[model samples]
Target: MAIRRGRGVAAINYPTGMNLGGDPTQALVHSTPTGNFMVTLSSVDLGQGMKQIMAQICAETIGVPTDRVVVDTADTDTGPHCMGTFASRGTHRAGNAVIQAAKEARQVMLEVAAEELEVNASDLETDGQGNILVKGAPQKSISIFDVALSAHFKRGRSISGRGMFLIPRSYPEKETGAMKPSTCYAHACTVAEVEVDDETGEVTVLTVKNVFEIGRALNPKMVEQQLVGGSWMGISHALYETTEPYYPNRDHGGTDFNQYLMPGPGDLAETEIIVLERPSGDGPYGAKGPGEMCANPQIPAVANAVFDAVGVRIDTLPITPERILRALKAQAN
Candidate 1:
C-alpha cells in the first residue's frame, strides 16, 4: 500500500487562574534612590519569562520603561504571598498585582515631583524615561532620580506600595456545576498535516498551524517560543512517550532521561502561528496567559490527522506502530 497524507484540526479553550480561594497573588513595588523600580513577588518564573512579563506590565502601568522595572521573584521568605506559578496564572494574577502596586508608587512619585517643581501633582506627567514634566510644558521637567532623592532626603517619604489581587470565588450550583472558576479563558485552534505509511504504520507530521486568541501579547517573542516548545512537547507525548509499557506488570520504567523516549528537534514540524488579541476584562493590560495553552489543541489535532490518514481509530497513546497495525488488520478483517 502507498503512503497516504491527511489533515485534521482541533480547537480548545484553556482557563486562566485556579479556583482556590480566588487564586490570590501579591506584589510589592518600591523605587530606589537611583531611580530604578523593583517589583517583588513570590510567584516563580519556571522558565516562562515571568520576570520579563511582570516587568513589562509594571513598566506599562507605572509609565516607565521596562528597563527601569526590575522583577524579584521566587524568594518566598522575602517576597510577598502568591499562589504558586501554574495553571496559566502567572501573567494574569501576578501582573495585576504589580499593576496595582506600581500605580500607587507612581502616584507617590508624581506627588513628590509636584512638590519639587511647585506644581500640582495632577499637572505632572512622566515621560517614561525617568523624567517627570509639567503637562504641556515639556521643557520644564525633573529627573526621577532627583525627585527620589528629594523624597528620601528632603520629604522624608518612602516611595513604596503594596498590592494584592483575588478573584471572587463563586459557589457553583450543585445541580448544574456551573460556576466561574477562572477569570479568563484563552482559546486556540490547531491544524495538523501528517503522512502515514500503510505497511509500517509510521506517521510523519508535516506541519502544524495554529491560531490563538490569548487576550494579549505582553511579549510576542516569548509567546512564540512557548508555542514552539509546547507543540513539540505535545508531539512527544502523543507519539513517543510512555512510562508503563505493561500496566499491571510494569517494565522499562526508570528515573532517568536515558530510560525515557522523547522527540528532539528532528521531529519538529513546520509551525505557523497567528496571535489574536481580544483583551480580557480581568487580566493586566488584557493579557491572558499563553504558556499552557500552546499545547492544548496540538495532541488532538495530530490524533485526528492519524485517523484521517489511515481510516482507523487507534485511541491509545503514543500511537505506536503495533497499535496502528493491529487496528488496520482488524479493519481489513
Candidate 2:
C-alpha cells in the first residue's frame, strides 16, 4: 500500500496560534535580501532536501538558478509565522506558496524588463540564470540583476515578497478559500527482508529496498539523501521507536535514546532507494513532498516482509520474537 500522509502530516506542523482544524494552513516566512534575482524563505531544511527543493521551485518560477536563490530559516522572531517543524510540509506547502508570492514579486521586474526590451512581458524569456532574452532578439536582453538595481534605484520600491496560505482552506460561508492545491504528491513503497532466529526469537532486517516517486528531482544528490534518511526513519519506527502514552508495559515511560532502540548505521540493511521521475504541473521545478510520504507505508511493508519470512502473521506492531513465537505456537496448534 502507498503512504498516504499528505493531509495528516500537513496538519501536524502548525503552531498553537494556528489551528490545524481551521480553514487555511499558514506560513510565517520572511525574506532576507535580493543579491541578484535571489530571495530567501523561512523554512529551515534540516536534512529532508527541502532547501534544494524550494530553491529549485523559486528559480523555476522567478527565473533564477538554484545558486542565485537563498533561504534563511533561522531565527523564529524574524521568519514568517509558521507552524513549527513537525510534518514535512516545508517543500510542498511552503514552497508553492512562496513560489507563487515570488512570481508576483518578479511580475513587476518582468514588466520592467519587457518595457526596457520593447516587448510584451509574456514574449520575453528568462533563461533561469539572470539572463532575460527578448523574443527574436537575443541581443536585446536585460539581466535580472539590472532589473533589481533599477527597481531599487529608479522605481524606489523594495524588491521583496511576502505571502501566507493555509492548506485545506475549508470554512464557513464567508470563507474566501478552498483546500490549497498541492503542488505535487511524492509517493513510495518499500520491500523488506528479515531473518528470525528460531531458537533466540531475535529478528534483524536483512535488506530494505525502497522506490519513491518524487516529481522533478531538482537536485539528485539531495533527493537521494532524503530518501535514504527517510527510509531509515521508517525502519526505526517499524523495528524500534515505541510511543508509550500513560502505560506501564515495560515499567518505563516514553522512548528516548535509552528506552528506544533505533537502528544504527551498522544495523541498517542494504538500502536501495529508487527515485521515480514525474513532472508535476503544479510543483515548483516539479518538486513534491518526500519525507513524510516515504515514512507512512513502511511499517506495513516491514510487517508484511516478516510474514513472508516466517510463514506466520504478527498483527501487533513491533514484531518482537515473543509475539512471533506465540504466533508460531498458535499455528502449531
Candidate 3:
C-alpha cells in the first residue's frame, strides 16, 4: 500500500484527494503422502473483514468450511510482499489472487483424485460445498476430506495452493507531477432537508435524508454504519468545526475549538438516511467505498436546509447565526 497525498510535509491543511492501493500474489502449499495441494489469497482483510472473505474462498479451494480453512498473509520475510491493505482495494485485488492460488492447489488434488479413482482430473469435481463427485459415478466418489487424508497418508506427497492479484496501474515515467492512474473508483449522492432561524441564524436540521449509490451492498449493516459514522463526522467538519485560515494580514492564529463554536447537543436535529444502491464496476463483490460519500453532501445539504428554515441562504460553510442574520438583513432590504 502506497499513500501519496499531494500535500507537502510542511503544508498545514491538506485538501481531500484520491487514495490508491494494490496487492501481490499469495501462495502456500502442503505435501501429504497421497497428494500435494496449496491455498491462495482472496485478499488481505483486517478489521474490515477481508479475512472472512479469504476464509470462505480458502475453504472452497480446499473443500472445507470457511471455519476450517487456515490463512496466512503474504509475508515479506518468508513470503512475498503483498501490497499493504489500503484504499479499499483488498477484496478486489486479493480476492482475484486467492482464486489463482486455489486453482494451483486444485491441480494437485485432481491428479491425486485421478490416480485413486483411475480417472482424469477433468472427470472429477470438487463442489465449493466440500463434496467431491466423479463425473459419471456420484456414489463411487468420496469427500475432499477423504482425498486430503489419502494424499497425506498413502501417497507420501504434499498438497499446496497459491493465489495472488497484481492490480495493474500506470505510473508516471517522467519526474513531472501528474495524477497516477487509479484502478477503481467509487461515487455516490445524498439529499437533506431542514429549517433555520433567520434572526438567530440558528439552523435546525429537520430530517437529513441520505441517498447513496453503493457499488454493491456487501454488508447492509456495515454500510449503514459507515454512513452513520461519516455523516456524524461530516456534521462536525462542515457545520460546527472551525480551524484558523491564516492569511498574510493575520499570519498568526485564532479559532480554537473552545473559541470557535460548533453544533452541540442542543444544536442538533433529526437525521434520516436513504440509500440508492448502484453497482460499481471496479469494487469487490460490487462494493464501493461508502466512507466518504455522505461527507461530500453534508455541507451542501445543511446549507440548503438552513435556507428552507429561515428563507435565507448562506453559501459559506458552518452557516453560522451571524452569517444568517447578515443574509436575512440583506434579503429584507
Candidate 4:
C-alpha cells in the first residue's frame, strides 16, 4: 500500500544495415544552371532529417556550401533504384552513394573550371565558397555560377554523375556459421528509474538516462531530437501501447486509433542522452544508423526497474495494473 522506487540498466548492440543479397542504393548528382547541385535518390526521409543530412553530405563531397545542395526524394519512379529504407540503412547506404555521385560531378566541375581558367584540372581546387581557384594562385579563380553557365552554353558539357553502392553478400562458410550480416554496429545503454504503487499496481517512470555509440552524429541537433523522442516511444511500448488486449481469442481488440491505448504528455519521463562517436570505416563520413536502436534499450530497462521496485517479475508488455496486482496476490499466497 506504498510507493516503491528502484533503478535498472540495460545495454544492447544493434546492427546498422542488413546484408540482404547485396543491399544496394543509388544516387544521382547534377549541377543546375544556377550553380545549385541536385541529389536524386529513392531513400525516403520518414521525418528523420534524411534530406538534410544527404544534402550536407553531397555539399561536403562536392566542395560547396550546404545551402547550395538540394536533395530530391520525390518518388521511386523518377529516382534511382534503392533497397527500401529500413534496417537503419538509409544514412549509411544512401549517403555512400551520394558521396560517389558528388565526387564524380565535382571532378567534372573542376575540369570545367580548368578549361575556363586555362589551367590543368590537377592544379584546380575548390574553396567551398562557390569558387574554383588554382591551387597556388587564388586570384586566378572562376565562380561556380560562371562555370555552370559556361558548361551549359559555351562548353556543351553536362556536369552530372551517377553512383551506386552495394555490399556484396558474404555467404556463410560451411565449416563454421561465420558471415558478415551487417555493415556496422551501434551500441547503447540505458538506465531507467521508476516508482511503483503497491496498492494500485501503477508504474511511474521517473527518469531515463541513455548513452549511445552511434559512430558520428551527422546532425547533432537532429540526433538529439531523435533520441529524446525515441525514448518516449520506448516508454509507451513498455507500459501503454497494445493492439490486442485479449490475445489467443481475437474477440476483443483495438479497432481504431481512438480505441488504442498510449501514454499522454503527463506520463512522459525526464530523459537525458549522451552520444559517443566511434566512426565506422564503411559508414558515410564514419556515420552509422541510429534509427531503430534509439528506442531499444529503454524497454528492458523499464521492465527490470519495475521488477526491482515490486519484487515481482512481470514478463508481459503494457505492465497493466491488473497483472501487477495478480502477481502480488500470488506472491502473498
- CA deviation > 4 Å runs, candidate 2: 1-40, 115-122, 169-185, 243-259, 330-333
Off by over 4 Å in 1: none
In angstroms, the error of model 1 at 56 is 1.2
lDDT tens per residue, model 1, 149-171: 99989998888888899877878
Judged by lDDT relative to the true structure, which candidate is superior, 1 or 4?
Answer: 4
The candidates, ranked best first by TM-score, are 4, 1, 2, 3
Per residue, candidate 3 scores C-alpha lDDT tens digits across 1-333 of: 121111001001111123344335455645334322334332355565666655555565566556556556544466544565654555555555665666677777777777788888888886666656787788767666667787778775456666555654445657785754555555544455554544456555545555666566666776677677666656665566545433345543344756666566665546665666666565444555555555667666666556555556677666666777788789889
Candidate 4: where are CA atoms >4 Å away?
none
Task: Give the Cα error of residue 18 in candidate 4, in Å.
Answer: 1.6
Which is better, 3 or 4, measured by TM-score? Answer: 4
Clashes of each: 0, 6, 35, 0
Give the per-residue lDDT digits (tens) of candidate 2, residues 1-333. Answer: 111111001111111112356322233222223435443555566766666666676677777777887666666676666564445566656766677667776677677777667789888878877888987878889887777766666666555665565555334445665543342456666777777665555677767777887777778888788778777887787766666522355554445776667788688877798888887675555666666766655667777766666667766666666777788788779
Q: Write the per-residue lDDT of candidate 4 for residues 207-297, one digit (tens) a residue.
A: 9999999999999999999898888888888887777765666765677767676667777798999999998889999999999999889
lDDT, candidates in the order shown: 0.87, 0.63, 0.57, 0.90
| Candidate 1 C-alpha error for residue 270, in Å | 1.7
- Clashing residue pairs in candidate 4, if any? none
Top lDDT model: 4
Between the candidate structures 1 and 2, which one is better when assessed by lDDT?
1
Candidate 2 TM-score, true structure as reference = 0.77
The TM-score values for the models, in the order shown, are 0.95, 0.77, 0.65, 0.95
Alpha-carbon RMSD to native, per candidate: 1.7, 7.1, 9.2, 1.5
